[model samples]
Target: DTAVSQTPKYLVTQMGNDKSIKCEQNLGHDTMYWYKQDSKKFLKIMFSYNNKELIINETVPNRFSPKSPDKAHLNLHINSLELGDSAVYFCASSRHRAAGVNEKLFFGSGTQLSVL
Candidate 1:
């Protein structure tokens, strides 16, 4: 009964490697967001997609790119993974078009990425 789902709950990779995390939502939301939680448990927005269009892109590294195939899916691909990139990546969605800021977002259980 998960509204949002992400693959590979645990990811272990080497430094300078590349990896991808896939996300999907079934709530028919208009906006999807990617967030990263660092070691200190601080969460920061990385990217956002509204109806498969890029809307908000924070000052993330160029090696990190987000691709949304449709309104239901958002994928994050990271290249040249660094030690600082080790964190928990979360996928969340909200009905930005309908509820504005009042809508609560649904977030997937994050993918824990560890760089060796």
Candidate 2:
């Protein structure tokens, strides 16, 4: 079984459209994250949830939100998407250790979003 999985592997939509990517991990990890990779290949963390509670809220636009129904799932919702939002969105999960440290993350195959 796959450790992490996401739906809609490729998405193409026009500006101002709303979209969401669903993610789930079977690894039973406690922490999940949403990461975005811009065209230039810079990866930035948008949100982090640990045990179904918001932990790290990065400086992402308000239009983007991370929704987690449970510790095993974290979904990314984008409202009024814009051209600059076109990028690869990744879902990752890891076991957080003591002293605020975490283990290696197991990432899902990214979802490519193209805003026209």
Q: How high is each candidate's TM-score?
A: 0.95, 0.94
Taking all chains together, the TM-score of candidate 2 against the true structure is 0.94
lDDT per residue, candidate 2, 44-96, as tens digits? 98899999999889898999988999999999999999999999999999987
- Cα lDDT tens digits, model 1, 16-84, are 999999999999998999999999999999999999999899999999999999999999999999999
Q: Roughly what TM-score does model 1 have, to 2 decimal places?
A: 0.95
Error of 2 at 89 (Å): 0.5
RMSD, every candidate, angstroms: 1.3, 1.6
Best by lDDT: 1
lDDT of each: 0.95, 0.91
Q: How many residue pairs clash in each candidate?
A: 0, 0
